[model samples]
Target: MTDHHPDPAAPQPGAAAPQSACPADWDPLASQRRPEDPPLDVLLSGTVFFDIVFTGLDRLPEPGEELWSKGLGSSPGGIANLAVAAARLGLRTGLVAGFGDDAYADWMWHTMSEEEGIDLSASKRFPDFHSALTCSIAAQGDRAMVTHGHDSPEPMSRLVQHAPAARAAVVDLAGETDWWGRFTSGDTKVFADIGFDETGRWDPADLAPLAHCHAFTPNAVEAMNYTRTESPDRAVRAIAELVPLAVVTDGVDGSYAIDQTTGEEAFCPAVPVTAIDTTGAGDVFAAALVLGTLAEWPLEQRLKFGSLCSALAVQQFGGSLAAPGWGDIVDWWGSLSTAAQAGDLRAGYTRGPYMFLDDIVPDHPVQGRRRAQGTFAMRSDAGHH
Candidate 1:
């Protein structure tokens, strides 16, 4: 068993230089095109199972090399991690993924069933396949992971068919070719989160089925790979041409989005926090983005919420342990604002309407203020009234 340990240098709330920004405009209904909520009921499909994560360790062994982990335990892996993050944030969630007949799978089932707002009727037991496992090695709060999938395509398809009513369906593109069409054709809003292989690569054609998906969450590296562009802005624009909503996250540099309607680019700054293990940080960000969309918090707020969730996610060792609840996120945001206000850093800082954190973090403090006001002006003119 590998032991997982959190990085000692990971930033605690008061430890690092606090990131401060003006609170985004609290517009509760800024992006509600429809009268009804998008879909609070979330169906999480794709890979699911216990992840045997190891932290405070090094690379996977070669032919023969001893490695020690500071901790070891099981938590939801892949798409399930997003589900857990959403559920913790008080969304009604369900799972449509395959599990194995192993003891680890049993634990996964039991834990997910007991989660406050998650429904697991769609989870299946695959006898031939063991539960998925991910072993992570943490160095300076960054992680390297090795994962194994024990299930085949056939069983995964069956599990997906059993999903209950869901407002949106989040699919981890773990090589699920057939599932995309089915979900998109259904009443569910589709969100695809693509995973990266050891080569740090994936094919853009893999996302073709999800062309009209409600949202696509890709990290900066994946965005570059998908669009074959060195510039994140160009990558986002390229992706938005394919999908209506393209969210590209760049670790500490921040994130950007391409608006499908007007072909505009929106950037948000990374919530400044000392990261510990950025293992499931992106997953957590994706989950929050989807949830915020469901709530119609406007594009800017949705991205900020995601940034806040991700910032909190990297403070711990494992993915699930680091995931923060809604209250914790609010506190973090509030703390950021408080810190910013207390320091002399507020020179020329204009607290415009609250936008996503990614928008403000990358620019000079004064520039961010100007950008925030400009965003509000554009939104006002763009029929967000």
Candidate 2:
């Protein structure tokens, strides 16, 4: 596809490359579609935030002090992060959430439905309400966020009287359970994650939702806290007893998984990269893991794919926009392969983890995709930055 985001101020090369007018779509589950299957591959529901990220900050401003940032990006965040990640990877994603009748809401609605191809049929827009907004500061290898907004007038559980059928649903364990029962009933699989417990209760009873879930993905700290285990490996194993599949993500070191349903256990190392911003890396990882699960890939392969996707996401800024498309994956693999062939030992070692993509990625050239505008500036005004 033609770059949706073009840098006009940059000097043009002597010979510009031809752009793809018609971006080719690569559906990883194209072979599995049936006439009776659900129209949506994945269903998601949560709050949507208009995220403004400030990067290149030496540090956050001190009290009553001011600082300048070198970079800025704007995009839809929260549930939109997972939605964009899944949609970019070719999943027929449907989102159910609340929105406001404001400019931020308008931009986000357009970006997700028109640009990202996410279905918003089940979502609603409330007049007179302001959309949630978050300002994030990235510095010193981590980020901090300040948000402002009220809860949706209507809870998602109440808004979703009847959840539509889907192959899979991604949900948080802390949400209401009334609507979840109807959605998790038949062939639909539920993948659950949990938020940090601010109360420090770390109570196992809070995780009762796992009884109905097919898989659970949690960070290493979350797993250890809930399972009372000291290490990620033990935490995953403990969690596997509750859900058929358990995945614990350990930043930098990688991820660990235990799939009791398939009788498999494995660990996948993280792909090393200089992270520019890590806004929605977990959402990307969850999306990739869901894709692998639906495609019936082995446990280890799924972890590796998820880790690779997360790695790519952290290299960019815009939370939802940072999600990588198939073209990004293909380009990354091609570049690594070329480097390895040219005697780059590091590329060779790094490529060994994703060798499985050889059989899965499409052989034909597909469109390359990246994040949208770094800022919400008009196209003609973008060059000023």
Each candidate: RMSD to true structure?
13.1, 6.3
The estimated TM-scores of all candidates read 0.72, 0.91
Q: Which residue pairs come into collision in candidate 2?
A: none
In order of listing, the candidates' clash counts read 16, 0
Q: How close is candidate 2 to the true structure, as a TM-score?
A: 0.91
lDDT of 1 at 29: 28
- On residues 245-264, what C-alpha lDDT tens digit does candidate 2 reach at each position? 99999989899999988899
Task: List residue ranges in candidate 1 displaced over 4 A.
Answer: 1-40, 57-73, 126-129, 141-149, 152-154, 197-204, 262-264, 334-385
Candidate 1 structure quality by residue, lDDT tens digits, 223-306: 888789998888888888787788888889989997674455678898777775676788788778777766755677777778
